[model samples]
Target: MSLTTEQITWLTKEQISWFTKKQTQTFTKEQISVFTKEQIQALIPQQITYFMETQIPYFNEKQIPWFTTEQIQALTIQQIQTFTKEQIHWLIYLQIQALTPTQISVFTSKQVLAIAEEQIPYFNKKQIKAFTPTQILTFTTKQISAFIEQQIKEFTPTQITYFNEKQIQTFTKTQIQALTKEQIKEFTPTQITYFNEKQIPWFTTEQIQALTIQQIQTFTKEQIHWLIYLQIQALTPTQISVFTSKQVLAIAEEQIPYFNKKQIKAFTPTQILTFTTKQISAFIEQQIKEFTPTQITYFNEKQIQTFTKTQIQALTKEQIKEFTPTQITYFNEKQIPWFTDWQIPYFNEKQIQAFTPTQIESFTEEQIKNSPQLLLRKEEIKSFNSKEINKYNLNNETLSSEIKNNSRKL
Candidate 1:
């Protein structure tokens, strides 16, 4: 016997299931539209599967909220594909978990995006792994933003690569922090560009180490600007050694005051030489004080010449004391002029005397005129020519004059 829509809606759950199983495929769209949300929610899993695929899309959006998670879990792929964005958006977290990978695979992009924020993690990474890269790419900015750390790590590199540059830009710092080294290694230059300064510092040390020379070279100056002292401190010597001169110079001058002692110690002198004159000149006095003197031998004369006179004078006596004779030899005559009179007494006879006579000869007339006399003994003074001694502006007569006068007196 045929029942009216009103009567059918009033039927008990058992009767409704029996009637649906027998006639569901034959039901007209108008008849199906009249089924109450309660009747749909009460259907047994087996009976829920009996609805015609064509009719499933007819269910009003409100009907999905009442369907038990178990009923939704029993949906076939064809039935799942029939859901409209409106219906899918209403699925609760429990029902979201109920969507099998087969069902998940059929969701249209809008339907997938409509998945609620709270329900995002229900993809149960296994489901995520099964998603084709194209399907994963459909994730909206908010949808991608909703991913938890573990879920983010499950994204395959190919899936991650499918992210349009704009979608990639939306990753939260927490999600960025979750990135595996292997995953980070696959980040494209375009994707790398979207990272904000605060986001980069969250990288684990291993993640930083895994950055390719290509990727590190791509960092925008602004990204480099926010890498704080501690964040910079986390990098290994090897990791830090990869920065291009431009990249290193892009770093905030103020951020790297410990450069020579800590960050720069890892750099070969050739690498250290890449710093711009301004960058080298920006060294705070504390940085100059703590700088390793042994590293000085690596400086080419040109690099050594960049240190301002003030910086030269700021060098502590102890720091200067570490300068090997080899280190002293690297200084050109022009660089020697930056030292002050106060610094003159600290150079012991060996370090000062290490300069070849030719380098001393290249000294400017002013350098010779003001040069210290006591740093060497009387014999050292005797080695100087009468002209060189005269350049010292000493009170005594010329050495040649002294010799002749003393002979005559004898």
Candidate 2:
């Protein structure tokens, strides 16, 4: 007779025990006669959970027939949970269509967690997202945190940069706050710059304040300069008002060397006047030292008149010391013509006597050559010595010929 649906719905422990005994070689024919194929077919729906849970060991030992995909789909949550790794894998592979959302959720949460923890790359994004919220929450804080940390740690520098900017805009405040200091340190300058520019509310005031002086000090010079520049704009009016003159001066002085003259001139009168006399003196000396000779000449005519004789003498000595010997000679030669009014001697006898006769002769020749009127009076002398030597050679040959003629007559 065909079994009723109610009969198929319930598989008792005694029935399972009877089936087990029947499968053994020691069982008698009466024991094996417990259920016909029709009865077993009716029993499948009811016994699926039982088969999945308790019957797997029996199936393995007795080499029982495999369940159809439809029968596997009928398995309960409890049944699916009890599956061994190999059974679950086979079920996933074979019964792919048989899984309901509920079954998939349960199976993934429990089974997939283990698989994912192994970091198998074959898992799809859809499969990863399929994890139930409850399953996700089931993970220990440390586990989830560690997994996130590992992902960040394993991220390439390029990936970290991309995520850092993206996370500032997209991640929840709590999520951003969850990152450890070491993780935060992975952010590149560009990433941090983006974060600061975006003004992420995720960074609590206290958290922002938590950056130590030493930590801020660790930033690159450019970064520090940028931060300080930003702070001038970012700080509230009250905070700005709190800045002491000394602080402002310190920043200005530190950056002044980098500023152009126009930038330097932008300082308020009071700010400009804040430079002590000693500082002003040092700055002047530095500027004077850097000026070229032409610039110095311009400055002497326009600016140096303001200085005392001692200062001018000091500047002159510096200029003289820096001049090349040839430059000094040229300067002296040019200035010597102007010395009569300055009461300087024109050319000392010792200086005049220092010139060699050859140099003097060359100098006199050059002066005459350079004179426009002297060129007309100068005569060119051709050398007659070549013609004389030729005539002498001819005479010697004729004399030698006469001597040979006389010897033959003899």
lDDT of 1: 0.70
lDDT of 1 by residue, 56-128 (tens): 9877765667788789888888788778777877787778777777777778666776677767877777777
How accurate locally, in lDDT, is each candidate?
0.70, 0.39
Going through the candidates in the order shown, the clash numbers are 0, 0
Give candidate 2's TM-score.
Answer: 0.24
The TM-score, computed over Cα atoms with residue i paired to residue i, of candidate 1 is 0.73
TM-score of every candidate relative to the true structure? 0.73, 0.24
**lDDT score of residue 108 within candidate 2:** 43
* RMSD for each of the candidates: 6.8, 25.1
Query: Ten-residue segment with the worst summed lDDT in candidate 2?
Result: 375-384
